[model samples]
Target: MAKITYIEHSGKRHEVEVANGLTVMEGARDNGIPGIEADCGGACACSTCHVYIDPSWVEKLPAKDSMEEDMLDFAWNPDPARSRLTCQIKVTPALDGLVVQLPEKQI
Candidate 1:
């Protein structure tokens, strides 16, 4: 399992262990971490799970696909270089220290 951290805009933090093959959104959702609405339930069909990956981990993650990139256009205050949809990120041992920050609100 990978240990991931979700930092809310208010400065609260939730660090959880996520099993391999599960998405980051699932990690947050299962742990009852707030901020990732995941309205579409990991289907990549919504922007509610938008988050900004820590700068150091940005290059470590897989590049966003066309569908995710397009959906990010509707995310709240997205950062061109750091924003990602939690649902699209799969957890693995390689991402053991992954950290993501939640935006103030979802759109």
Candidate 2:
């Protein structure tokens, strides 16, 4: 299992054990972590699952796709380099210590 750390806007952090092949949004939703609404259910249609990957681990994840890039434009606090849809970040052994920070607002 990979460990994921979710940091909230208020600076609260929660770590959850995620099974391989699971999406970051799924892990947060399953653990009842606030901030990631995932309104599109991981279909890559909504930006509600937006999260900021910690700079340290950003290089390990796959590059964002066109759809995600379009949706990210609709997200708050969009960081060209760090913004990503949690739904698109799959958990793998290589991403063991993934850390994602939630945006202040998820509209």
Candidate 3:
């Protein structure tokens, strides 16, 4: 399992261990991390699961696809360099201690 830290808008954080191969969005949703609405589940259709990876971990993640990139544009608080669709990031041993910061809003 990999440890993931989800920081909310209010500064509250939720940490949980998630199995490898699962997407970050699924991990947050499963662990009941507030702030990640994930309206479209893991289908990558909604930007509701958008998150900003800590700058330290940004280079460690896989590059985003065009679809995911496009969807990110619709996110509530977009951060060009760090913003990403959580559903597109698969957990892995290398990402064992991944930490993502939630935006202030998801609409």
Preferred candidate (lDDT higher): 1 or 3: 1
Task: Give the clashing pairs for model 2.
Answer: none
What 10-residue stretch in candidate 1 is worst by lDDT?
Answer: 8-17
Candidate 1 per-residue C-alpha lDDT over 1-107 given as tens digits, one digit per residue, 9 for 90 to 100: 99999999999999899999999999999999999999999999999999999999999999999999999999999999999999999998999999999999998
lDDT of each: 0.96, 0.94, 0.92
Ten residues in a row with the worst lDDT in model 3? 90-99
lDDT of 3 by residue, 52-83 (tens): 99999999999999999999989997999999
Which pairs of residues collide in model 3?
none
Q: Give candidate 1 misplaced runs (Cα > 4 Å).
A: none
Q: What ranking of all candidate models by lDDT puts the best one first?
A: 1, 2, 3
lDDT of candidate 1 at residue 87, scale 0 to 100: 97
What TM-score number comes out for model 3? Answer: 0.97
Best by lDDT: 1
| lDDT for residue 71 in candidate 1, whole number 0-100 | 98
